[model samples]
Target: MKFALQAKDILRNYANILYLLIGITTGCVIGFLFGNQVESIKFIGDIFLNLLFTAIIPLVFFTIASSIANLQSSERLGKLFAIVAAVFLTTVIISAAVMMLVMLAFPIAQDDTLRNMAAQAALDNPVSSNSNTSATGLAQVLTVNDFSELMARKNMLALILFSLLVGFATLRAGEKGKAFATFLNSANEVMKQLLAIIMKIAPLGLGAYFAYQVGVFGPQLIGVYAHPLALYYITCAAYFFIFFSLYAYFSAGKQGVTVFWKNNLTPSMTAIGTCSSIATIPANLLGAEKMMVPAYIRNIVIPLGAPIHKDGSSMSSIIKLAVLFAMFGKDFSAPEMLFAIFGITVLVSIVAGGIPNGGYIGEVFAITAFGFPMEQALPVAMVIGTLVDPIATLLNANGDLIASMMVTRIAEGKHWLNSRLPS
Candidate 1:
């Protein structure tokens, strides 16, 4: 019985890592061996991403509504929101600073050769050139002309606001509200279970997706754009370890840092492989549980943070901005440029949920916010977003758990980690 239990524990702990390794190995082998023929298996990746996308809307709506409804009092909800918001804002500011410094240290220079290659690539794969005409201003983002528009993935900010309204209304509706909240809670569980089932096949899905991407793009692109891509990967790793570790330590002390990294291993790997923070929420919640955070805190913070608190997106946006500025021969050190980068990245990060490949959507904001040439700048930004998205998602997904821990510590006012540790 003991050996069986130990074996089960090991498998459970290492499942995500095993899957990631298998997927990467399979992708490399298939991509190298079959070349463009690997595109035939692209459907496997599409199905996986589609499955993840299908769950994101309901998961966000139900989880947020249910979490707020369960708060049971306006005061508790207010306090939770305040703490979460403060932590999120602080992290965003830190991420922005880190990104700025990294960009300054390793500036991407424009190369005509690379630009020509990118142009060729864009020509080979003709993407829709339609611009996002939706309201990106603060007022428009917060306002909905039609409530139905909130259902669209692109209107994530409006969707979250609508969910909050529904949650609050459910709280005020007496017994009817209670029943509805209960339904939402049940629905949230169902969505989670659905995610768990989808994750079981992640190896096959991620493998096919990566194989297709590599086969289509080939190693030539990586070689052409190695500097910025490598720099982005290295910077994200530093932020994950240095900034995140320090945040955890301050929140819950040495033991807090220990528990956080120990429990986050699988979730971090899962994020890298799947490249979707929404898909990794379940694993993050499990990590929070392992760190001894209360269920209420995990339920509230993880879901809400997944969409709103995007440290990774902020970092990636900075990278995109840096790349675009260099490619267009604009000075990134200008005060206005710095302010615009900070403001737009923070705003866009909040609404990054709902849209498929939403990371690329930031390019639209860059057009309006910084007046970059849409024709030249947008394509380069899109390519950069695609290449660095997996790492960005990994950062976003891991930061969600870390931020949850910080919020838990603040809300509970007691060291949640202390009691769980050995003497």
Candidate 2:
């Protein structure tokens, strides 16, 4: 009887997600039949993306600033960031470890074609190194020269840092800043609702976009790249189903797993369809809320994690290393090599996740670290990154929602979910 109630509740409460699923599935079928001919319809998805992108600037600013400013106790703010950082770093390592094991067990791909390509690539491009004296490049990544630059989506790390500073300032104001805090909180609510409204068209927008993706990239999933693509998608799917369930169970026991999977579908689909972690923030926020995670935690984790907490990238970074190592005939089975790959993947997934051109940054770093030919290694890894993006984004985006559960259990006690449940 309880199971029946839960089933009915999911169907009733999550009906819109079902519609989205149906729409995307239908779109994929349509795309398969028409192939590249659907290019004309891309404008539909473009419009939705533009609206979302424009709205996101205000949404992120308001959510983070308000969450910080409106935090009732300053200590909670400290705990939140502390717990978040720990969770993010821990999960990144876990993800990398899981993928490394899989890669070691089953090498990505070893082919003469890849080797020949690598040789040609080495001849084509010269290797370059960083100038030791310069911290300028690092500074630019975390902040922008002009305040106006923060308004752009490309400068997300800068924007997040700026938002944190604003929130912290308002918080430190105490009672004297009550009015501004209220205003920030109010703005956050309004922006959240606006994002919700924008997402109402997710079915149409995401469906159309998914169609385009299928029509364009579907054919590339064959020949040389086919095996590597299969490995990634399959590994990601297994991790998504298995590890996420384990995390959810750890967070709140059996009930947490139930609540999590019920609410996870929308965020996962949104990530898959959009292939952008930033775009899936709202869905993740809503998903966390539905699971009864505290708003303060979700508000902070979802926005920040969307940019940085990349379980998916952690896995993919390892794959990139594996592919490069294979291409170069390196002893990937060596413990020393895996140790180096482990450290690099962790850095690439967590640190580069927030920076622009993170893919390029990660790929180039992997190439240089292994002394792989940059010319050949870079392009091959780039291709793999593109191929795995959708699934990777699925893991990266949804990981935040589940992380909120972990934080809640730790911060609010193990009985947290029980209180949120009906008596």
Candidate 3:
């Protein structure tokens, strides 16, 4: 009876995660049997992504605007922002450090076959035009020229800035803005409910996408550059298990670790299946709620974190830089190269965090900044980026949940879990 009771409790709590696992497993089997034919079912996944993406634009706006609008004072919000920045920087550095060790332990070796294939592929299919990314390209990314453009997903950073401005204006309005503030809160709650409804089909959606991916991309996973792939995947796995747990424990001791794992797996799986940190924001927000992080911290942390606070990008950037360095026979550990690699890792994570495939911009930046021949280096970097993307995104997406906890602990004190949320 005791064993059965415990089993029931576990099932009740982890039902969603279990269903996601089953869905993915089923998708994998179907994919393997059908091979590339499974791509036909990709529309099933596309529907889910479209629904989620459409919902996200409004979700982000309302969540940020509402959370900030509700803050009692600008000082409180400022403190949270300061803490969020500190936590993000600290975690990114730690991720880079850990991967630096991993690279030293198992460095990438030059593969003539891989290099030759990369050269041929580059010739046949020119890489994206990011190799010449200019100042105008960056302006288009950061802030759209028109107000209507802000609604688009590609302009997330701009939307966030606008949301923050709206929030500040509402707060500054005092008594006159009470109705607007209330509406913001109500709309945010509605969006939250809408997200919950969308998530019901996640398993099915994720399954179909995984089927398509496995069918199409599985063969490409194992090749001459497999060493770099293994190194990246293994390092991500270890970092998540070890460092994530440590972050949780420090947030609120053993209880933090327990709750985090309970809230974590679902979001992590969603991230992996979707291969997008943006899509994972809804899950991450829910996880933060379960962990009892205040709205101010989570609103700023999770949404902002999705784009900028990517430890995964930090690790992978180092790996990509090293791989290119090895291919070119450059000393990766040279003092100046090490310094440049570290700076570039942080820059890429921040500059490229919000946009889809923004890493291409960073790769271009790296290639040009380091004086690597864009024609030769860009293709290698793009291939490695594509390969490592799934796991790297997993780290980047779920990382926000842990970061929210850290921010709460720092800004609200260690007893933040039990303390009254700041008004």
Candidate 4:
């Protein structure tokens, strides 16, 4: 019996290792072959993107609103929002700074095919062209007359603002909004059911999305784009160790971080296997409890933090947007990059504390936040969405543990900086 159990464990470990190899090799192949054939690869990616988000947004809306309602005081709600915004803003600025520094070390060349496509479109719609439009320019034209309006109208900033409004209002209504809130609350439950049905077919979507991406990108782009990919990987590894470990040690205590990491192996593994933070919440909650986090913090913070407190996701967002800007042969001024980071973090952080399985939709929202061309933004999503999910989830899970510690200290009115170690 013991031997059989050992063999099963070994097999499972090997299977996971094999899956990583397959996914990397597959993604490389597709990205290389289809690097220039943007439309076809994008179509497949779009299908998966749509299917992933069809039910995710509404579910997040209600769950977040419901979670806000659970707070004992409006003051606590204000505090929570403040903490979220601060953490998100800090991480975004760091990511954007890192991305800017990295770009200086690895200059990009514009893809001729993408440029040709833009030129042809400009000619076809000459009425759309203005004095600002140029035949040789690689960057997409952004007209001052409508750029900010388009960004707002598309709902990147609006979705976040509206969600916060709904959450705050839901808290304010003495009783009149109770029925309407009740309907949204119930709707949130039903949406989870729909998500469950869709998730069962997630493997199908994953396989097609990846296979189609690999078939298009071909195998050679990895070698062709090795420099940037290498830099991205280095950034990922550096954060995983340096920033996260330091934060964990200081915030959660060294012993707490070690215990949390050791016991929460299952959640990390599940995140990697599924590539969805929402799907891994059960393991995350269990792991936090095992690490001795208070029940209230575990139940409330872990679920809410999964979507919102994505240190790695925010990091990857800055990197992707920076890369897209560079790929079009445009340089973002430091101020522009700073604004992108600040704005993207706010937009992305709105649904952060929502229900599970909403990561993909958040990715879509991030792409829209910056108003990058869909072709460029979508491919980056394919790369980040497929590879970054697990790493981001681990960071997110860690952030929850870390944030809970800070929140608990705040709630207890304890000064964390000068407090003595617990006896």
Q: What TM-score fits each model?
A: 0.60, 0.61, 0.59, 0.63
Q: Pick the TM-score winner.
A: 4
Q: After superposition, how far is residue 80 of candidate 4 from its true place, in Å?
A: 8.7
Tens-digit per-residue lDDT, 1-423, candidate 3: 997976676566446556665776688678878998997898887687667657767876887788779878735556667888899999999999899888877777656643553454345335322322332465665567789977754455567678889999999999999999999999988887787777678678767866865686563424545787788999999999999999999998887898899888789877876677888999999989988888877888999888778899999888888787776566777766677788878977875674334265456556655545454465456556766877888899988999999988887788877564345
Please list the C-alpha lDDT of all candidates, in the order they appear.
0.72, 0.74, 0.75, 0.54
lDDT of 4 by residue, 133-187 (tens): 2322222322223334323323433444455567678778857767767777787
Query: What TM-score does candidate 4 get on C-alpha atoms?
Result: 0.63
Q: Which stretches of candidate 4 lie over 4 Å from their true place?
A: 1-100, 107-109, 113-156, 159-167, 189-229, 248-304, 327-334, 349-358, 403-423
Best by lDDT: 3
Backbone N/Cα/C clashes per model: 0, 0, 0, 18
lDDT score for candidate 1 against the true structure: 0.72
Model 2: CA > 4 A from native: 1-77, 125-223, 355-358
| Per-model C-alpha RMSD | 8.0, 10.4, 10.0, 7.3
